[model samples]
Target: LCLALQDRLEKVEKEVQSLKGENLALKLVLEEKKTFASVVKDGEVEVDSWKVVAASATKCTLKRHSAVDLNNRFSTLSDEIRDCGQTRVMSTVIKTVLLLAPAYVYLYINAVYSLKSSHLHYREPLTDLVSQMQETSTAVQNSTNGGHPSTSVYRALEIDHTKASHSLWSEDAQCSKFLVNFGKNIEGTLLLSFPRSGNTWTRYLLEGATGIFTSSVFNDPSLTKAGFLGEVSSLSHNNTIVTKYHFLQKNHHATDPCILLIRNPIRAIASLWAFKIVTSWDVKHVAVIDNSRYNTSEFRNFYQNMLNRWMDVIRNALENSRLRLLPMYYEQLREDPIKEVRRMLNFLRLKPNEERLVCVARHITGKMKGGQKKFNPYTKNEMNQAQEAVKIVNNLLVKRGLPPLPDYSKYEN
Candidate 1:
């Protein structure tokens, strides 16, 4: 028992030495931790932090970042987010433009095509309509015959005078007439005639033959009541067979064809004075008055003034008119009414109907003609002045390749 006790004491001493060595090691480790903490507070030591990166379910790695490195990483992450947002917005804008591109392109192409077609439609000549109608009729006839066209071709017929019918203009003796609306498809002609140049009578003949209304610049109630339905219509409306205008000074740019009716100044002035005196100064009177009643010295100064005016109107028209001109004489119209009417219609691009023309021939002298002949109201000097004016107009007409006026000294119409 003594020996066993001794052995146990030795073992206890060995264990106490081992414990002292362990305590010394632990104190060294604590001192090292305190020194490191103090160094950190003094900014002499840098600290590193680790992040775990999982490669797989069973595998992992550590990633370390310092404070400065962490801030750089966050800044890089924020920049990536901002860039992604900007890229998404730009992509959306590109997609939207792409979606609308086809529609904008289609609209631009369609507008260009429509503008070109409209120009072509308006610029086409009005005379082409007749050929187009004929072609359409021929095509339809051929189609109806099942590609075996007729041997007899369709053709437009000339005016046949043998065909007889009642008047298409009026049913009564008052020259009251029916008129078709002059549609937009037909272009207009200008009837330029000076005052008292048988313009009213010519309008009567035109309406009788064509059954189309003639428009006047002045809206005279008397003439309107006497079948001038388009008297009040505007000239720019362009819906009449002929529009009467005495003054073309402001309308020098008119492209319409003109029918300039000329009359002997002596007779025209005499007839105008008689008509004005009879109708109380209404210049648009449609009535034929007694010329012998007003043939006196009162016509001397008026005749000179009217002769100058007559020359001025003719000179202005010949100088300023830009389109085709058909110069007509009232005496010629009085002599051959049917021929003159047909000539006028042809110039207007209208096909004359024979039945209506026959009616015009039958009523050549209208109700306005009475039982009296016109008297000469001009003096010998006035007559000489009228001849000189005619000579000047005739020279101008010859220069323009138009026919000259007849000898007015012997005119008896």
Candidate 2:
């Protein structure tokens, strides 16, 4: 019976060992389930089955899990790549805009203000909009007192006239009514004369009467003398004025009933000499008795020679049949400008405008100031020399039906 009990104990012990081994296997399986649950919760794997096989099972389940993980990684990498590409494109566009911003702003402001300024706009080709804008600007400028519209208009007209050829005098063959009545049909009237022959005074008197003379007229001395030519040229071209001044060199397309103003040769020489001395401060030191300078010899020879030359120029100018060379003495202009001017008006076939005559008279006389006094009487030697000169000049005057100069001896008192 004791031997039977020992065998039973051994059997009991073996059974206990078996139960422990089973329990350990269950624990391992529970631990594995917990780990797998955690991994699955973290999105590492998805399981098709929970069967635990050891020796006979292949690694198919793990391999399947690895493939799923690889696919997920590929999708994440692809999404990241797409997002990076979009970010790069946006960044490139923003950088381009930043680089061009300054130049764009500069161009915009310049177009609006500087490029559209009035002077700049005038240079642009005329469009419908630009034309309307210019008209409005001109109107506004005219309305404003300080805008100087007249000056601007005058400048524009002057520039246009300057670019035009001045030789267009014969383009219009219309004759003046006065020239028609005077038994002549010519293109234009010319006031012919030598240089420094009171031309400025005459122009001043004529222009001042019309209230057209301004400070600009006399600002430049050279222009003050020749400015009348330009003025009359412009007026003649526009058919505004009937008469004009020609310095004799530019004689083209003659007109009838023109006037000539002549001076006493002796007085003209004296005036010119005085002018030269006063202006140049250079005394002419050549001996008048022996020097051939300026055709001077003794005062007598010079006077007679000058008178002859004067007559020749006048005669040559008178040869033009279209010209009505009215040779008026300079003394007549000084002594009685009104009567002389009236005679000139009558020759011009113009009714003497009393207001214009009065204005002209005032202007000529008003210019004679304190400094324009007559020269002192000739010296004893000068008087004797002048007396001889007067005799020769008087003979020529008498030959031309002009009054002879009085003897200087009679004026010694």
Candidate 3:
């Protein structure tokens, strides 16, 4: 660019020099045409030293004073004009040099943008490369965890939690059979809820929100293959499980954080009766009721059993400092599920942005949602007794710095 401007400047200088030469030639011609002409016209002899005729057909004439010196002033002005032209050009060049960085930057940006526009067809390849990088990362993780069979039932989604060094299954041979050592272990989070108190619904909610499967610590035949500590516990420390009971370890084992899902005691007892008596799911109660001290009436038996279980679990959690227990209410879950689930996620130290739809619809109860023949069958006296039992438990819980149980008398028959 500088070279081009230099050439242009040279051309301008040549034109200026040519104009100066023409002016000089005209001065010489006027000097050569100077004639002394005396005219006796006014009584005194007045003289004109030079008169120059025009060279063009327009009849323009030039008059020159013989004594007036104009060359010095005219030449000085011509030289200043030449000097001004050179100064202006030099100023422009200096400014251009100072702004070169910005000029280069502008050109570079345009060039890059043009190239990108022309190569728009390569977008798919770039996308594919990003996908491949992600797939490679996932493959590396799977390999680090010991490769599972392609037909492996292990899930793709997982809850990330800190793992405790201890195991739930002690040295028992039966429990030891489930221990598998395929990969790194993580201490799992415990999803605890009183049975028949939205436990199943909470499990489903966690699964749908996190895309991770919750395993049962119970050796339920359905989840037998779903153990987490490889073969021993269905809950692998690498994942979180929603279990009904804390495993009966010798001195209580340290594991992941626990979330307790509970409901108003009255409703919970009613649901327990439905599970044990009406549905006969509590086989221990159903199978050995005749041989035990439990009341002959299943409602009374379930109420007493579940209440004791509730107090035991809550008291245990309260006493154990290592147990990080987050208590969630079933009524709150049923009323505004999203808010409760978000609270649970925050408790687990997990991001609630995982999924907004908890998929609790499957476990939602309707007006007629009872175990076999169910209704508001408890009398006011029975309801009052149940309320009092819950109050005693709540009083103790409050003294222990835990939350009180809600009154569920409204749910009584």
Candidate 4:
């Protein structure tokens, strides 16, 4: 019975092993099928995604190409339109010019022939007409002289000096008569002259002489004043009694003293020219006043005109006994400043302050700290021009009953 039991046990073990092996094989087969199915599904999804990406990329490329073509067409259209408009404008301008060509030619010919005939014949009426024409042309040339409104030629011609009489004295002569009254009130006052002259320098000297005053008193604290005249006018009207104005103008109070300061015309012209350069002036439509047709020659003529104007002013001032104009030479101021200052103080009826006189000398010499070097306007060429101008001025001065300028030959060297 034991032998039979052992045999049965061994058979049972073999059956269990066989069953285990079968189960393992089935599990392996199922796993292999699952892996294969998963791989196939993933590959299908990838292929579909790639196809979609390709279709979308192609569509975007086509859209971009269409946009580029549209832009090119628009640009081409714009260029064509611009070209057409330009061509039309050019055609119109050409037609207009052609139509007016004959009229312009006729006018130019008439003007030239008339001018030539007037010059050739000594006909008084024709000469007068020519003069009027010349004046008109000059007015046109200097239309933008001061950047002011252009004065018409017709208006200029119509401006008859006889009809537009300038009164010697106006009803508001109270202000105009200031210098006359000044001589009575102030013991002695210096009458400074020059249209953009070194009136500021004269004021500085006056301030230095007073020593009790500041530079701020002499210099324009607010740049509202046009010039020394304007400043004085304001002060006189405002009743500011600190210091008096050096420069004189029309409509001054009758009670003010007058001390006239004069500079060499050529030097004054050069100084003005330099000032104009640093501060640009209106130069459009400059009149060609030069006899030589060169720019330098024209500048020389302009300088002469300025000198002539200055001479006229000087003569008028000197002749006016009521104004009590005391002429002071710029050269004298430079050479013997202290002596001149004292002389000026005496003329103004003020006692000479020696300390103040010293300060004036120092200020003018630019010896003070932070003082600027004086601007010298004369050059070699300018010196030559000045000599020529002075000769003419000397002749005018003699004619106007004034002494001629001292020989400036010593200064030329």
Q: Which segments of candidate 2 are over 4 A away from where they belong?
A: 1-187, 209-256, 277-308, 366-413
The C-alpha lDDT values of all candidates are 0.53, 0.35, 0.41, 0.37
Mark the regions of model 1 whose C-alpha exceeds 4 Å error after superposition.
1-181, 250-253, 280-297, 367-372
Which candidate number has the best lDDT?
Answer: 1
What ordering of candidates by TM-score runs from best to worst? 1, 3, 4, 2
C-alpha lDDT of residue 27 in model 2 = 15
Candidate 3, residue 271: the lDDT equals: 55
Tell me the deviation in Å of residue 239 in model 1: 1.8
**Model 2 C-alpha lDDT versus the unseen true structure:** 0.35
The digit string of per-residue lDDT tens for model 2 on 254-315 reads 34444555554444554444443343222221111112323334444544455455555455
Model 4, residue 359: displacement in angstroms?
A: 2.8
**Cα lDDT of model 1 overall?**
0.53
Q: What lDDT score is found at residue 260 in candidate 3? A: 63
Candidate number that wins on lDDT, 1 or 4: 1
Indicate the TM-score of model 2: 0.36
Among residues 3 or more apart in sequence or in different chains, the pairs in candidate 1 whose N, CA or C atoms overlap within 3 Å are none
Candidates ranked, most accurate by lDDT first: 1, 3, 4, 2
TM-score of 3: 0.45
Task: Specify the highest-TM-score model's number.
Answer: 1
